[model samples]
Target: MANHDQVLDASGLNCPLPILRAKKALSAMESGKILRIIATDPGSVKDFDSFAKQTGNPLLESGEEGGKFFFLIQKA
Candidate 1:
């Protein structure tokens, strides 16, 4: 796994909150940095995928473990 520049724990946040919080966090990070988002919402799988596509930020990795979703996004 690539080292994350920051981790955004969006656990328990549903729908757009995780994506919103990730956007905010990404804004604060330098270009080319990686942001790790940990969330519980199953919708986040699609949400993050769309967010990455719409924003042109590459979704480096995504998966689920122990009922939680994890996304690694590389800032554009």
Candidate 2:
């Protein structure tokens, strides 16, 4: 079983890897929980934004820091 909150580090991974990992993580989480994802792929920004919109999961936050893209997704 996964914890209520989790952080997934996907830095250095390319497209689809980060999103795929996020999807898997979200699948393991309960409703209302949050998942933090760290990705280095530039495409992840747009991919995750669209994923969140399409999946109906709330995107709590998205930004870049220390040359990495970070996303906080709340499971609905």
Candidate 3:
């Protein structure tokens, strides 16, 4: 189910790229909108958590399916 307003597929990208793309996408979105990010890097889980805290964005959902990681970030 898609519960987010926007989606950013950063799959195959490592560390900073995923976080960087997410930041760019979120920057283009309005406050209160949710950005769904799809990533393959295992470290992205922790990276997203830190990014959310640092950027003031709320991580609404975080989970994995198959081989991909998903993150739902609500812009603050």
TM-score of each: 0.95, 0.92, 0.95
Q: Kindly list the per-residue Cα lDDT of model 1 for residues 2-73, writing each as its tens digit.
A: 689899999999888999999999999899999999999999999999999999999999998788999999
lDDT of 3 by residue, 1-76 (tens): 5589998999999978999999999999999999999999999999999999998999999999778999999999
- The TM-score ranking, best first, is 1, 3, 2
User: What is the overall TM-score of model 1 with all chains considered together?
Assistant: 0.95
The parts of candidate 2 lying over 4 Å away from their true place are 1-4
- Model 2, 15-43: lDDT tens per residue? 88998999999999999999999999999
Local lDDT at 23 for model 2: 97
User: Number of clashing residue pairs in every model?
Assistant: 0, 0, 0
Clashing residue pairs found in predicted model 2 = none
On lDDT, the leading prediction is 1
User: CA lDDT of 10 in candidate 3?
Assistant: 94
Q: How displaced is residue 24 in candidate 1, in Å?
A: 0.3
What ranking of all candidate models by lDDT puts the best one first? 1, 3, 2
